[model samples]
Target chain A: MIEARHLSKLYSRGVYALRDLNLTIAKGEFLFLTGPSGAGKSTLLRLLLREELPSEGEVTVAGRNLSVLSSQEVQAYRRSLGFVFQDFRLIPRMSVFQNVAFVMRVLGVPVPVQQRRTFQMLKWVGLQHRMNALPDELSGGEQQRIAIARALVNEPQLVLADEPTGNLDPDLSLEIMNLLREINARGTTVVVATHDRELIRRVGRRAVTLDHGRITEVG
Target chain B: MAALRYAVEEAVASLWRGRRSAVLSIGTIAVALFVLGAFLVLTVNLERLAADWSQAAELSVFLADEVGADQQRAIEEALATGPVVASRAFVSQSDALARFKQMFSDLAASADALDANPLPASYEVRLQPGVTGEAVEELASRLRQVPGVADVRYDRQWLDRLLAAVALIRRIGFALGALLTVAAGLTVGNVVRLALHARRDEIVIMQLVGAPTAYVRGPFIVEGVLQGGLGALVALLALGVAFWATQAPYLVPLAAALNMTAVAFLPFITAIYLMLGGMLVGCLGGILATRSESR
Candidate 1:
């Protein structure tokens, strides 16, 4: 579960990334955050992930007050949330297995458990055979799958994805969106940020729309 | 076991991610350390030589031939009894003649034709350490007044010159050491900066994941250590090359006179410290660079 109250993010004078944003996301819910570019979508995501501090108000994810958490504790909070990036941000030099194992390694998970879980997650994504392949060797769709696999490997309670389908075609985008829905069904709350209005209308999930750094509409 | 695997995995991946930068940085560090190691070997061993020569300083006082054997004993007793003298030993006239012959055989051949023992009996006196130069000179003058004492002499000039040379070498070594350390730091810093630039996106992603500062910093620190260790190994190679290249000329009598043989290279402990120091500088630079980018 994630909650934000009176949240405001002012990047600079007269440049508010988010303002007076109050929101509550229940457990196991799949939601899309959409608007045109520069809609403060990314800022909201960053704020909720504790990647950036809010200029005002509070944020709680999994019942932990992120505003009060120290930097160390903030890291613990983030570990409970899986974040997927648009760029697929896999270190191009590393193999698929290493990229997925990075989160567990950072959190100091045991080797046996890390390996077992990573392999299992890779298999779930149907890419267990590509564990040794580097990102460059994989296509766009395959790389996206690897990214999703990594996001879910830690079994996070909340999954935050920023433009997960921005670089994919309409067909690939639907496939990625479906995968996110399946992940959400498996007891993880999913928040996706995107500008694909057609896909959002078609999927018909809860949509939070932003414009010029303000939450302008909700559907 | 998991942490080890993580460290290894991270280290290898990080190295591979920044292979060109890592190799170049380590090479530069190694070259600098090699110069320092070679210079250190010479500095330490030269200090030992100077000390050896300082300890070897002793006075040779020749006694008058007319003095009777019992009077020689009296003179020896008197010299031994003096407050300024730490210890004194007498060389019999016959033994003195034999030693002189052994030292300079050609000179001894001519002296042997003198019919009598040309070398006089002598007292070799060693003063206690910390004895003032003026005090030793005055002490020698006082000893010359002793009965049966023919003459007294001490090599104060020789001892002072040796001490001065050793001091000069030590000062130079210290300055060079400090300079090399600063250079090594700068080298590592530059390398780390370049590495941070290359991995800017990766670091941003890690920060986004809310990896602890330690978690974000660990692999870079380990990378620094790897760079340092490899640098040290290269420096060792450089030291070996320099040592071997200069060994033939430095082993001659001239080299001995200048104390080259006695001046050894870097000690085992110092080598380890250099490697660690290199790693520390690399890590410090890395931390500073990433601190700016991680945000």
Candidate 2:
């Protein structure tokens, strides 16, 4: 569950990154945030993640107020959600297994459980064969899959993917999007930010469009 | 336990990944600690030598020739009951003359040319342990007041000068050691900062994945402690080598005089304190480096 009431972010005097934006999404819903560059989609996700606070109003995720959580509490809150970045953000020196298992490691899951779940998640994302391969050695598609596996390994209730397919070929982008769809079908809420209308059309999820720091449409 | 192991593994991994920086930091710490350790060794031995000199201080109460056996006995009784006197021995005129001749064997013929026994009888006075400078002076004044005692003398000025020099050396050594410790800490901080810069991407990713600040900072702290510890070890090794190299016939007598074992392993207490100090410096450096925004 999530709620944002009149959330606005001001980067500087006379410049607004997000202007009094308000939105809501139910549990287990998959949504797309679409807009041109500088449309506040990333800002909204960052606010949800509590990486930065809104200049005005509040955002809540999983019943916890983002504005009021202490830094330590914010970190704990983040652990309950998953994030997939456009760049995959894998530690290049680490193997695929390490990349995916990192989330579990942070959460202090027992070694045996981490191994089992990481292997299972990698298999689900069709990356089990590349477990020992470094991020640099993997294809763009494989790397994204590894990122997806990492995000899902902790079984977070909500997953936020910031332009998850921004660096991939069309075919690879579609594959990554389909994997996200599969994750949503398995009951994880997913919100993706991207301007790729073709991919948006292909997936046909509920879409929220923003422009000039305000949400312009929703379908 | 599992989390701690993971943290330690991460720390070791970071050190390995940034081996060049680690080496540089460790070397810097070693050099700083080496200077500190050398100063400490010198100060410790010097203090010991000063203490030995202070403990050996004695007062000589010379007696007049007109003092007969009865007056000498009276003075010996006064000395025996003196609170400051730990021990005392009477040196008769004959004994004193023999000692003077032995001390100046080249002047034996000159001494024999004297018509009468010129040496005066005296009482050699050893004071109680931990007697102060004022106490020594008071005892000397007391001895001068004794019946038939002509002169009471001790090397008070020389002892005072020796103590003052020791105190000055200690103060300077403390200041220099503190300055080098700070330098070592900053060097470690710079190294940690470089390691953080090299792994910035990983740090960002770690944050995004919900790793706590402690989790992210833990490895750097461990790295700092390891660097400091290794540096201290190197310094100890160097000190041991230097001590060994110089502990032969050159310092054996000095060591024996000071009642210290020749080239014995660094006193356990001193070694422990030095290691603890090194670890603290490293910890400070780690904390300084982690104060910046890692994400």
Candidate 3:
């Protein structure tokens, strides 16, 4: 589902975020990207998301080169995937329902369908009762679940989570991982970037470890 | 459809959140449009006044007191033969005095104190329809050279001057309106820019989530449009109130002095165009705000 070939991202004046990396993940597979700070895990996720252009080489997903997509095409491509951030990044002013329905709204889904799908997703995440609650009012675990619901509401083929449990307690982190596992069981590809080796062991999926911008180990 | 709905809702909510700036922008637009609308009202009425007077344009050839019968016959013959002359009425000196007295009753007592009627006999000559101002002037010049013709006055000359003044006013109105509109547009852009700055995080999140450009930037544009639209409406309402206030207290007497029947407010179509112009300006501001963000 994802491929990177000799991918190297350079920063200003001799700073390298990612250096000559190559990796591939099969379709519908759940994969973990484990790395320390400055190990280029988030950089890889950004490349996959097409948020920035690769300074050298290319990243391809579902057979389309991410670097070559037009602005409009990039938007369409991003809509085809779900992204969960460490901060959850729900619009602060939006209610739980609005946060989830926002993706469908941007896609021009009819209001009624947005309501139905948003409700179903919230229900699945067990946050349906907090539909009218704002992001600031929700607990850390509840907010993360709301973010997960938002990610899956659009029914994306691939989901990328960048430290999805970074701000949560250990128990909440496990709960979020379990929810991601459930999403992956439904045949959606999932890639999570984190440094939690214990959590990686618990998931027991294919995991790649990165050190100094290069993949050092894979299991 | 969904995008449009969201844009509207977001625009309104954004404006509400930044109501102070929104009001300031709207007020600027209102003041600008009000100035333009004032000129519009002025020129419209002046044009109407010119049209009414043009319909009654004629030449007045005042005769000398010692003018002989033969000189009168020569003038009458010239009037009869002129192609521009539609009709002519000869007012005797006494008849001219009586007409003046009837028209100005307050001045009758002063006229009665005179031992003799000082008013001159004249020919009131109506011109044919569509006679050019130059034609009337040329005809008046010719009559001035005729023997015993004391002075020749053509209404078309003054009417032409009035029209030239009206044209100048219209041009000035447009020039000032253009400048103010630019200011208004920039003000709206500034306000929207501030809103964009406040929502920077939300914007990043929207972009990361793959919201289309329209969904992300559409609200700002819509906000500008609302500002412009509301500004125009306020301007129109103010214009209406000013028109009503001045009509009885000032415009009526002024119209009477100018020999005009009545002054008119802006036409319905013109008011609508003014409103639409406001909206267009607001749309431009929105575009300006969003354009910088795109960079």
Candidate 4:
């Protein structure tokens, strides 16, 4: 459901984040982007999310060109995908329920439907008991679970997680990884970027490795 | 409907979350609107006073003592046909003396000391509506040329000064009101900007989640409107209290002299205009705050 052709992102002073990278991921595929710091893994994911423009390439996701979409069209296009930040990025002042329900609210869903789906998603993520709890009150693993529920509440076709387990312990990381796997198994395309090779080895997923702005390995 | 509810809920929540800043914004708006309201009240009353003075204006053409009845009749006939005269009344010496006595009731002994009637028989000429300045002067000049007329007099200098004062007040009031309006709008804009800065992370998350621009902007705009509206309400209350405290001893007599109703001097329309002005200022502020996409 994603395609990139000769994608190259350049920073100031002649530094390249991604250099002439061509990549594709089929629908409902679970893909891991493994790389060290400054290896362009995050840059590639940002390109897919259309959060940044490439210096010398084009990206198409689900048949829509990211570079050409108008601002309004970009927003509408982004609604079809979900993003999970490494820090979990939950609104600090809101409850877990509010954080998850926020996506549906943005979609203009009715309050009753929002309540129902938010509760159901929280239950699926084992956060139903802590729905009314604030983000600061939750453990790192629990917060990540809330973030996952938020990403999945809208039932988006694709999910992009950038270092989703970066702040958690080894056990919590595995738990979050397994949750992402289950989400992928449910017919959602999942792309995760992480430098954690042991976690990648444990999950046994198809992996693409980037080094020095180039794809070094794929398996 | 669902979107509107959410927007309102978010707006209210935002206000509650940032109550300190909200209070500061509201206070600033209130002070600005209070200045505007004071200017409006003063201008309206000044205008009423000017109109009252203008309506009472009349030209008095004094007849010469040696002129005969025939000459006097001819002058009165000319006055009746004059274009500027809306109406004219012939006041004889006795009638003029009676009016003077009534005006200075405490001077009865002084008035009785006079051997003969000192007042002149005159034509009290009421000009048509809107006759003023050079128009009145021209009409007075024409009256002086008529037979049996000794002098033509009207309180033109005082009227000119009053009208000039009114015009000056209106001009200054307009300028100050405009300045305060702009300041109020900018204050609201600054407040919204600060609120946006406070919620920067939340905004980023919202953008990442594909929240439309309108969805993010709606609540801020609504918050601005609430601030402006509450500020205007406070200003109106301040104005009302000011008017009440000063009315009986000050504005009542002043308004009475101007032939106006003291309580109605500030019309209902002024209040409506003030509220709408506040709302418009808020909307402008909201637009300015959200104009940039840098965030």
Candidate 5:
């Protein structure tokens, strides 16, 4: 589903965010990119998302090279992918239902379908009762669940999460991981970037560890 | 169409969120269009008055007292052959005196006290419907050169001056309207910029979620258009009220001076165009503000 050949991202003078990295993940595979600070985890995710272009190499996802896509093509490519953030990043003014339905609206889905999908997705996240509540009113765990529902509302084939449980308690983190695992079990590709090695050890998935902008180990 | 609907909903919501700036922008647009509308009203009515008088224009050729009958006949022949002359009536000296006494009864004694009847015999020559002012001037000059003609006066002279004044007013209106419209556009852009800043987080999130650039910027554009459209409405209402309020006190007397039966407001089509123009200016502002945000 994804391939990175000699992927190197250079920042300003003498600063390399990712150095000569080559990686691959098969379709429907759940993977973890574990690294310490400045280990190029988020930078790699950004490159995969086509949010940034690699300085020296190309990253391809689902068969299209990310480097050559037009502005409009980039938008369409991104619509097929889902992204979750540590901050939840939900629009504060929107209710849980609106936040989840926003993706469908952006895709120009029919209003009836949007409502139905949003309701179903909220139920799946176990936030159906809190659908009318604003993001500020929800706990960190519930907010992250709503964020997950939003990410999945458009039925994207791949979901990339950056520190998805960085703000939650241990039990809440485990719950969110379970939700991600269930999604993976349903045949969606998942890549999570985090510094939490304990969670990585428990998940027992393919883990790629990086240090100083280079891959150090793959277990 | 779906995008347009979303834009409108988002625009309305955005305007509601930034009601203060919206009101300010709308007020600015209203003032700009109102000034332009006022001049438009003036020019429209003044042109109407000029047309009315032009249809009734006449030239009066006053005859010399000692002119021979043959000289008078020659002048009459010239009037008869001229293409610009629709009709002509010869007013004898006695008839002219009689008209003076009838029109000014209180001053009849003053005319009686004058020696040798100061009024001269004249021919009142009505012009053709669509004769040019230059044609009337040429005809008047030709009449003055007639052997017995003392002087020639064309009523269209004053009408020509009035039309020139109307043109000047129209140009001034256009210039002022253009300047105000620019200012209004800038105000709209500023207001939309403020809204963009307030919703920067939302915008970033939208972009991250792969919202198209149009979807992200659509609401701001719609917000500008609403401000302009609402401003145009307010201007039209104010212009109507001002026209109605000035009818008895100001416009009535002005119409009387111009010999016009009534003063007219702006035409329905012109008002519609003004509304559309306001919206267009707003759209421009929106476009200008978001030109840099394209990703």
Candidate 6:
């Protein structure tokens, strides 16, 4: 579950990355957050992730107070969410297995469990064959798959993606979205932010649209 | 403990994953630590040597050849009553001759070549505890003015000069230690920074996922400690080699000159402290550099 109430984020030089936004994502729901460039989609997700706190608001995600949790507690809260990035922020020097196993490693899962879980997740993402391959050795789509495997390794309650298919072709984008949908079907809440109208129309999930720092539409 | 172990594994694996970067960083740490260790070895030994010289020191004053057995007894009586003299030993001409011959075997034949009693009789005087440098000098002068005395040689001057040099070296060693410590810290910290930079996107993602700052920072600290530990190991190995490599060139003859009962390498205490200090520099550097970089 995620909720933001009348949140406003302002920066120096009168920049409001987001303004007066109110939204709630229910448990186990799959939704797309949509907007054009500079439309505050990333800012809203950042607030939800507690990476950047709202200048004035209350945000609650996964039953934790995002606005009031200490930095440490915020990090704990982050561990509950699986996150995908537009650029597939995998450590290039690390093996595909190492990249995916990172979250569990930090959580200090036992080696057998880590190997089992990472191996299984890579298989689910259709990347088991590239487990030993480095991120650079994989294609853009495969790299994104590794990132997705990393996100899901901990079995987080919610998954957030800021443009999950930004770098993929239409076919690859559809494939990645289907993977996300499959994850959603398994009872993990999914929220993706994207500017791709064609992809959004193709999937036809609940969509929240933003315009000039405010939530303008939700369907 | 499991958390720390995981942190270490993550750190080491992450660092080793970037092989060239890890080697370069660790090499920088090792080089700095080696220099520090070498200086530490010299400083510790110099301290011990100074103490050895002080403990063994005494002033030997030779008596004139014409002085009778009675005057010699009188001078002994005078030195016996002096408060500044803690202890005294009278070496007769025969005893002095025997000791001189024994000390320098190459010069033994040269001693027998002399027709007269070339090695004179002498009194070896040890000064009382708390006798100042000035006290030793003035006492030696007083002894030289005695009726049976020919010339007095305290060798306190030599002691004073050696102590001064030791003090200077100790000062220089401390300064060098500070400089080297800073250099080591910076080198390790910068290495951590480089590792973090190379993994910048990974860090960003970690932060994004609600990974706690500590979790995000844990691996880097682990890497730092590993670098420091390896540096210490390298330094210790180098010290072992240095000890053996110089055994024939420096230790054997020096040990012979001192008439040491047993020769030894660098003290174990010095080695332990060197390794600990080097490792500390590394761990501290990692924490500091990552803190700044992550922020």
Candidate 3 residues B132-233, lDDT tens each?
A: 788888888888888989999887978889899999999999999999999999999999999999999889878877889889999999999999999999
Q: How much does candidate 4 score in TM-score? A: 0.95
Clashing pairs in 4: none
lDDT of 4 by residue, B1-295 (tens): 6666767788788888888888877887888888888887887877776676677778889998778988987788777745578888989998988899899988867877999888898888887756768878877787788888999998866878987987888788778878877888888888877877888888888888888887878778877888888888888999899989998998888777767765344588889888888877887787688665334
Off by over 4 Å in 3: B63-86, B92-121, B128-132, B145-150
DockQ (C-alpha based) per candidate is 0.54, 0.74, 0.75, 0.78, 0.72, 0.53
Poorly placed runs, candidate 2 (over 4 Å): B68-70, B81-83, B253-265, B293-295
The fraction of reference A/B contacts recovered in model 5 reads 0.57
Instruction: Put down candidate 2 lDDT per residue, A30-112, tens digits, no spaces.
Output: 99999999999999999988889999999888899999998788778888899998888999888999999988887788899
Provide the lDDT at B236 for model 1.
Answer: 80
lDDT of 6 at A187: 99
- For all candidates in order, the CA lDDT equals 0.78, 0.85, 0.92, 0.86, 0.91, 0.82
Candidate 1: list runs displaced more than 4 Å: B1-5, B16-20, B62-78, B81-87, B91-122, B126-151, B252-295
- Model with the higher lDDT, candidate 5 or 6: 5
Best by lDDT: 3
| Best of the two (1, 4) by TM-score | 4
Q: What would the per-residue lDDT of candidate 2 be over residues B84-137, giving only the tens digit for each residue?
A: 778988898999989999999999899899999998988898876566778788
What CAPRI class is candidate 6? medium
Model 5: per-residue lDDT, tens digit, B169-283? 9999999999999999999988988888888888887877788877988988998899899999999999999999999999999888867899999999999999998998898
Q: How well is each residue in B20-48 modelled by candidate 1, as lDDT tens digits?
A: 87787787778667766766776666666
What is the Å distance of residue B248 in model 3 from its true position?
2.2
lDDT of 3 by residue, A1-219 (tens): 899999999988787889999999999999999989899999999999898889999999999999899999899899999999999998898899999998888888888999999999999998899999999999988999999999999999999999999998888899999999999999999999999988988888999999888999999
Best by DockQ: 4
Provide C-alpha RMSD values for all models, in order.
Answer: 4.0, 2.1, 3.0, 2.1, 2.0, 4.7
